[model samples]
Target: MKNVSTREPGLHKGVLYAMLAAALFGASTPFAKVFVGQVAPVSLAGVLYLGSGVGLLACFLVRALVQRGQVGQPVALTKPDLPWLAGAIAAGGVAGPVLLMVGLSMMPASSASLLLNMEGVLTAMLAWFVCKENFDRRIFIGMLLIVAAGALLSWEQVPVLGVPWGAFAILGACLCWAIDNNLTRKVSASDPLQIAMVKGLVAGIVNIAIALAFGYALPGAGTALAAGAVGFCGYGLSLVMFVLALRHLGTARTGAYFSAAPFVGAAISLIMLAEAPGATFWIAAALMGGGIWLHLTESHGHEHEHEAMEHLHAHSHDGHHQHEHDFEWDGSEPHAHPHQHVPQRHAHPHYPDIHHRHRH
Candidate 1:
C-alpha cells in the first residue's frame, strides 16, 4: 500500500485564490449599489462588463508581449471548449449582472450582498447532482444552513408579496451564476486570462447592445469609468482567480470558499452605504459564517484511481505528473504542456482537482 499521506499541494493556493476572488467580488456588490440610481440597471451592467473586458484585454496584451515565445506558457482554448465557454458567458456575463443590477436597485446593498450567498448553495447542488462531484454530510449540512440563511435574509412581512421581488431577482442572479460556475469548470484547464477576457468582452458587448436597443441611456463618462474600474477588479480579476481556484478546488468547493464574498460585500455596504444591520442580518451572518467554517474544515482522503488521459495545463513535477518530457526542456518547476496520465491508484487527501475527478 502506498503511504504517501500529505495534503494536496494546490490546497492552500486554491483556498487563497478562492478567498481573494470572494473579497473582490463581494466588495464589488456595494460599489455597484452606489451606481444603482445613477444609471439604468441594464446600462450599468453593460458598463461594468465592458470595463472588465477592456481592462483584461489590455492586461492580456501586455502579458502576451512580456511572455512572447515562452516555452511553458499556459495552454490556449481549443474548439471543444467553446460551447462551455459560451454557456458560461451567457449565464454569468449577460444574465447574472443584469439581474444583480435590477435587484440592487430594489434593495439595500447589504441585503443584496448577503442574498448572493445562495449562489454557493445552488452551485454545490448542481455540482453534486448534475456534475456528480463527491460530497459528505458536512457539505450537505453546510449547504442547508446557507439556504436557510438566504431564506431568512430574503423573508419579509409584505402581505401581498411574501418576498420582495428584489430578493427574487438577486436569487435569479445567483442561479445564473451557479450555472455559469459549473459550465466554466468544463474549460478550467485553459488559460484563465483568455477565458475571463473573452467572457468579459462578449458578455459586455452583448449587454450594452441590448441596453442601447432597448432605449436605456448611457451613463455620463465619470459614472461609466467608475463602473468600469469596479468591473475590472471585481469581475475581471475576481473571475480570473475564480477560474484558477476551480482548477485546484473543483466547482463546489471553490463556490464554498467564494461564498465568503457576500460577507465582504455586506461589510462594505455597511461602511459605504451607511446601512444599519438589523437582527436578521446578524443572524444570517452567523449562519453563513458557520456554513463557511464547515466547508473550510472539510477533508477527504481515500484510494482513488486516475484513468489514463491526455490534456494540457500548468503543472509541476508532483506525484500526479511522473511522465518524461520529449523535448530538451529547461527544468522549470511549473510549466504547461500537452501530457498524458498513466492509470494509477493511491490514497491521499484530495479535492476534485483537475487530476482527481474519479467518481467516489
Candidate 2:
C-alpha cells in the first residue's frame, strides 16, 4: 500500500498558478474589447481562438518532440472519455468565446464584465451536480451573494442593452463554460498540455469555419497583430495555467479562484481605458469580495478513511494460501487493531485495515 501525505507546498504552487491564470484572463478582456471595434465579432472570435490554438500547438509540439520517446504510448481513454472531450470543446472552447464576443460587441464593457461573472456561478453549480463535489451550505450561500452582487453592479447597464438578443449569446457562453468545467474534471487524469492542445486545435478550427460562414470581414495588419497577442495571452497561456491548476485544485475551487478575473478586468478597464463603473459597481465588487472571503476562509471538517493490509504469503490449512493481518490507524485519534485473514479464491486477505486522515 502507498502512503499519501499532505504536501502543503504543492497546494501553494497550485494556488499561485491558478491566480496567475486568473490575472491573465482578466487582463485580456479589455484587449478583446478594443479589437471589437476594429473587427467583426465572428472574425475576431475566429482569429483569437485560432491564434490561441496555433500558439498552444506550437508549444505542445516542442514539448512532445523533446519527449519523443514517450510518443505513441497507449492512453487509457475509455468510452466515457470521448463525451467529456467533446463537451469541453463545445462549452469552453467553442460556445463560451463566441457568446462572449457577440455580447461584448452589443453591450457596455462594464455590463458584459459583470455578466461574465455568471461563469463562476454556473461552473460551481455544475461541479456540485455533475462531479458530486463537496460544497457546504455556506459556500452555496456565498455563491448566491456573489451572483446577486454581480446583478446589482450591472443593473444599470441592463436597461441600456434593453433585451438585446446578443445578451442571450453571453448567457450561452456561460452555459458552455459551465459544461466545460464539469467535462474538464472527467479528463483531468490525462496530460494537461496534451489536453489543452487538443481542445485549442479542435475548437479553433470549428470557430474559424463558423466565422468565415458568418461573413465577418478579415481585419487589416494592426488589428490582426493586436488580436493575435490577446489570443496568445488570454486563450493560450491562460488555458495552460488553468489546466495545470485543475490537476491539483479540482473544478470547484478553480472556478471560485477564477471568479476574481472579472474584477481584475474591471480594474484594468478603469486604469488603462479610464472607464469608471458607478456606485453600484463598487457595491457589487464589495459583495463579491465578501463572497470570496466566505469561500476561502470556510472549511468543512470531514473525516476520510483508507484501508491498508499486511499479509504473509504461505500455504494455508484451508487448502489455500494463508496470511496474517495487521492494522494501523493514522488520523486525529490513533488506535491499532488486528483482524483474521480469510482466503477465498485468492491468497490475499479479503478485507484490509483502513487508515483515516484529513485533507487540506
Candidate 3:
C-alpha cells in the first residue's frame, strides 16, 4: 500500500460556511412572505431564482476575468456533472420554492419559516440511509427532535374537516430540497459558483416559462427588483456557501448546521411581520434548539483505510495530497488538476468529505 500522511484542518471553517448559508437563506423567508399578496406564487418563485441566476452569472464572469492566469483555480464542471445538476435544479430550484411560496401564502410567515426545518430532518435521513453516509445515535436523536418540532408546528388545536394543506405543501417543499441537497453533493467538488449559477438559471427560466404558461402576470418592476435581490443573496449566495459546506462537512452534518435557518427566518418574521406565535411555537423552538445543539457538539474520528482514487478539486500540499505534478513549475499551494490517490491506510478525525467517503 502507498503511504498516506495527512494534514487535518479543523472543521470550524465548514461550520462557519454552513452558518452563513443558513443566515442568508433564513432571512429570505420573511421577504418572500411580503411578496405573496403582490405577485402570484409561481411567478414570484421564478423571479427570485432568476435574480439568483443573473446576479451569479455576472459575478462568475468577473471572477473568471480576475483569476485568469492564476496558479490555483477551482476545477470546472464536467459533462458527467450534468445529470446531477439537472436533478438538483428540477427539485430544488423549480419545485421547492414554488411550493414554499404557495405555502407561505396560506400560513403565517413565522409558522412557515419554522416548518422549513423539516428540510434538515429529511436531508439527514436521506443522507444517512440512501446515500450511505455514516451517522451515530446522537445524530439520530437530533433528527428525532427536529421531526417532533415539525409535528408541533403542523399541529392544529381546532379540528378542520380538510387536511392542513399549507403545512403539507411546506413539507413537500422540504422533501424536494432534501433530494436536491443529496444530488448537489455529487457535484460539490466542482466549482460551486458555477454549479449554483447554472442551477439558478435553469430553474429560473423553467419556472418563469411555467408561470407564463399558467397565465400568471409578472409583478411590477419594483417588486421584481426586490425579489431578485432577495434571490441573489438568499438563493444564489446561500447556495454557493452551502455547496462549499457540503465539500467539507458532508450532507447530514451540513444539513444539521443549516437547520438554524428556520430560527433565523422565524425571528425575522416576528420582527418584520409582527406576528406573535403561541406557546406551541416556543416549545417547538426549544426542542429544535436542543436537537441542533446535539448536532453542533458532535465529533467523529477513527482509524480508516483509503483505497486508490482519482479526482480533482482545490488542494494544498498537505498530508493527504503528497504527489508529483505532471506539468508546470509555478508551485501554487492550492491548485486544481487531475491527480491520483495511491492506496493507503491511516487514522484521524474526519467528516465524510469528498475524500473521506470511505466505508465506515
Best by lDDT: 1
TM values, all candidates: 0.89, 0.72, 0.88
TM-score: which is higher, 1 or 3? 1
Order the candidate numbers by TM-score, best to worst: 1, 3, 2
lDDT of 3 by residue, 1-360 (tens): 333434345546777888899899989977887898898888888899899999999999999999998888778999999999989888998888888867876766656755776888889889999999999999888867756765566565442324578888888999999999999999999999999999989898988898999899999999999999999999999999999999988999888877777667767777776788889779979987888788777777777887899998888877678899889658867788888988777776667889888777
Model 3 spans with C-alpha error above 4 angstroms: 1-11, 98-116, 146-171, 273-289
Best by TM-score: 1
How would you encode candidate 2's per-residue C-alpha lDDT over 1-360 as one tens digit per residue?
A: 222233343235555666777888888988898877787777777777777777777877787677565423323334566788888988888778878877877877667766766888888887777656667688777777766775674455444667777678787788889889778766654555567667767876787788778776788878877787788788778877786667656677677767667667767888996776778668878887887677656544332433344322111133221233344323321111223434222122111011111121
* Candidate 3 whole-model C-alpha lDDT, 0 to 1: 0.84
Clashes of each: 0, 3, 0
How many residue pairs in model 3 have overlapping backbones? 0
RMSD of each: 3.0, 10.2, 3.2
lDDT of 1 by residue, 259-317 (tens): 76766776777787688988988898888888877877788889888889999888887
Report lDDT per candidate.
0.85, 0.65, 0.84
Clashing pairs in 1: none
